[model samples]
Each structure stands twice: as C-alpha cells, then as structure tokens.
Target: MSFKTIAAILQGEQEFQRVLDCAIPLASRLEAHLVGIHAEVLPVPYTAAAGFPDTDFIQVSTELNKEATLKLRGTFHERVEDAGLSFEWRTLESFSGDGTLAGLPNVRAADLIVAAQRDVESDDGTDVESLVYDAGRPVLMVPHSGPILSSFRRVLLAWNGSREAARATFDALPLLIEADQTDILIIDPPESSDDTPDAAGSRIAASLGRHGVSVGVSVRNSQGQSVETLIQDRLAASGADLLVLGAYSHSWLRELLFGGVTRSILRSAPVTVFLSR
Candidate 1:
C-alpha cells in the first residue's frame, strides 16, 4: 500500500543533489528506507590505427572516475547524515559499457525508483529509459529543472483504460488517497459501444471514491492538438502537483520511431510524473 524501500538514481553532481532533494522528503513522508545508487563507469582503452592501446589515457580516465565516485559518496553520506533517515549507499562499477546499467539490480529490488527526467540537451550518459522499463517498478520522475516537490497535494491521473494505466493508478493509490484532490483527465477518449466518456470516467472515480479519495473526472476533446499538449495544459489549469499515468502503453519501438503520448509526456511534463509500464 505504501513504499517501503525507495531507490534513487544518482548520475552527476548537480543531478545527484536535485534528485536527493526530492527523494529525501518523499522518503521521510512515507517513512521508507532510502537507497542511493551510483553507477561508476570505468573508461576503456582506445586502440590506435596500429592497434596500440592508449594506456595513459585509460589510466587518467580511471583515476578521474574514481575521484568523482569518492566525492559523490562523501556528499551522499553527508546529506544522509543530516537527514537522519534510514538509508543505504550503493556504488556499482561498470566494467563493460553504459555504467548506469550497473544500478539495475538495485532498481529491480526497490519498491519505487526516483530519478530525474532525461535531459536531451546536456545528457550525462544516464540511461533513464532502462531504469523505467527494465526495473519493473513504478518510476517517480522529477523534472530536470522545476519546483522541488516536498509533498504531493493535488494529483492528475491520465486515464485511457489500458492495463498500464490501471496499474499506474493502483500503484499510485497511496499518493492519491493522501492528496487533497485527485482529478481524472480523459483526453480523446475512444468510442466504445459499452462505455461513454462520462461512464468510463465515472467507473474509475467510483472505484477511487470507495477508497476514500476525493476524486473528480474531466473529459477533454483535445481539439485536434497533440494529447501531450492538452495534458500539459490541463495540468497547469488544474494546478496538480503530480501526474499519474501508465508509461509506454503503445509499443516502445513504435514510440521511438514515431512519437507517442508516453514519449511526449516524458520529454516535457512540467510536474512530477508517476509512471509504470
């Protein structure tokens, strides 16, 4: 019903602090054990045209990565000490490739994973998609740069009647129940013989109401605009602090090639997003 263990992905100096800033308060609020995971990528030696390896470059890169890891660990310990919460630090060394992959084990074990939204502009080589898709747990993605979330009050649930949507809604029940108000926003609803827009929304609202959550439903037509645009507009209008939705309801490869709702939301949702695949 509540998060018992929360895993936070720490990528760089600035992002580490930002993710921790949000994760600390969330862990405190839920009284959950916090785990900080840092994946240290080891540099591989490059070969010259004649097949000679650049040993010096490799050695220097290794030392730099080690120093960075040490500094990050020290900062993590200091922050955890100040917070005085149940916490653990995990450091994984990447021997093969994409150091962030080393943290997958911790991600798999966690009840919830906290990570920063991907920054395509200044990417730090963190594979956030893998963490979300491969972890098999709900991911709480904080905006790369936005208002820090000390708590979630108003929540907006993006419902589309997919299994992923249902899972995300249930997974976020703890937050929904705790929120002052939760709005269900149905955009460009499908025309089904069995259910109308109002009927579909009412069914979910009634379920949430049974759990003692203050629930409201709104169906928007989107007016021929992208669903993501409409969702963002609604989010601002509703003033919801958190967004709960299923991730990648469509095929991942399809989304990667042709844009989909999941990709659009991940790239530019202003508020915190709770996503499960």
Candidate 2:
C-alpha cells in the first residue's frame, strides 16, 4: 500500500530541479528508492549534400548530448547526496527525442511515477503530456506554475463510478491514508439501477473510511458548466493541494471527438494532479 520506488522523469535542464523538489521529500517521507530518469536524443543520421553518411555531424551531436547528460547527472548526485536520501540515476538515448516515451520500461517497473505537467503556454515540453495515458501506472503531475507542495495534506478525489475512477481511488490509498482529509466529489450523477444519485459517493466514502481516511462526500450540480470547470472551482474553494483523478474513463476516440474531462484537467489543473488509467 506504500510506494517502495518512485521514478522521477527528468526532461533535460528545463525543469529537472523542480521535478526533484516534488520527488525528493515524498521519497524521504515514504522511505522509497528514488530513481532519476533522463533521456538524451540520439543524433539522426540525415544525408549530407552528396547523400553520404555524415559521421562528423553524428559524432558532434553525440558528444554535445553526452556533455549535457553528464552535467545533469552531476546535478542529480549533488542535490540527492546533500539530502542524504538514497537514489539511482538512469540515462537513455531516445530515437524519438522524447524522454517520457523512451523510459517506459523503467518507469513501468517502479511503484510510482512523478512527472511535471506540461507548461500550457509553451510548446517546448518533451512529450510530458502523453506520460499519464501511456505509463500504465499512477502518475503525480506537478503543476508547472504555483507553489510546490512538499507534502499532500488535503486531497480531492474525483469520482464518477467508472472503472477508471475505481482504479484511481485504490491507487491513491497510500496517500489518502496519510492525508488529514479527503473529499469525494461526484458531479451530476446519472440514475443508476443499483445506486441512487444521492448515494453515488456514499458507497465509496464508506469503503475509504475503512482505511482510516477522514472522508466526506459532496455532490454538485454542474449547471451547464464543464466538469473541469466545476472541479477547478471546488479545488479553489476546498484548498486541496492534490487532485486524484481517473484518466480517460471514456474511449480515446470518444474523448477526441468531444472534449474530455481528463484532457481538459491535464492541460489546466492549478494544483498537483494524481492521474491513473
């Protein structure tokens, strides 16, 4: 029920330090093995003027990437050692130039994955948006803006009675068990044959209560507003720092055709988000 190993996705020098700030303290609190994963893009063997293999271009590119990677490695050691926390650094060469996609195998092996949410204003992020859907593990996405949280004190769990929501609720058990309070939110619940709309969140609340989590259920009327909008409003009011969400409860095609809750939240969540598929 506790995270034994946490893989922090370090994407170059852009925000590696911020990612570490979120990962290190949590790892220390959980006493988990912290893994630092970074990927360097391999030089593409494009043709020269004469269409011959350009060795010089490849060699220079390789060296430059290596130099940057080594520097990042040094930074990792200096910070982690200073904290007196156990850690391991992993580096890989990605042909696709996407570290998040390249480190899938290693990330899958860990108990949890910590990633930075893509900066909504910039297009420079290295495929960080795809990590949540593809990782097959619960991902804690740190917001690119706002105050970084060293601990998750208040939590908000979004529930819709879907399989994805169920998976997310259980995946967040470790954190919920430690939180001071957890609120389950269900918006505009549909009529169910087995359960009533009033009790939509009640069942889940009772289940979580068994785990010793201080839990409460809240049902809100969306009132024509988007689900993401209401969720964000609640987050601001409740002052919850962490949001536990089930990603892609609907099909991929369905989400693409119509705007999805998962997609909207991923792009614009103000606080840290815990996403599970």
Mark the 10 consecutive residues where model 2 has the least summed lDDT.
123-132
Summing lDDT over every window of 10 consecutive residues in candidate 1, give the lowest-scoring window: 95-104
Q: Give every collision pair in model 1.
A: none
Candidate 2 lDDT, tens digit per residue, 71-119?
9899999988888888999998887756788899999988899888788
The global C-alpha lDDT for each of the candidates, from Candidate 1 onward, is 0.85, 0.87
RMSD of candidates 1 onward, in order:
1.7, 1.5
Scored against the true structure, residue 106 in model 2 reaches a CA lDDT of 90
lDDT of 1 by residue, 45-69 (tens): 6986778998888988888888998
TM-score result, candidate 2 = 0.95
* Highest lDDT model number: 2
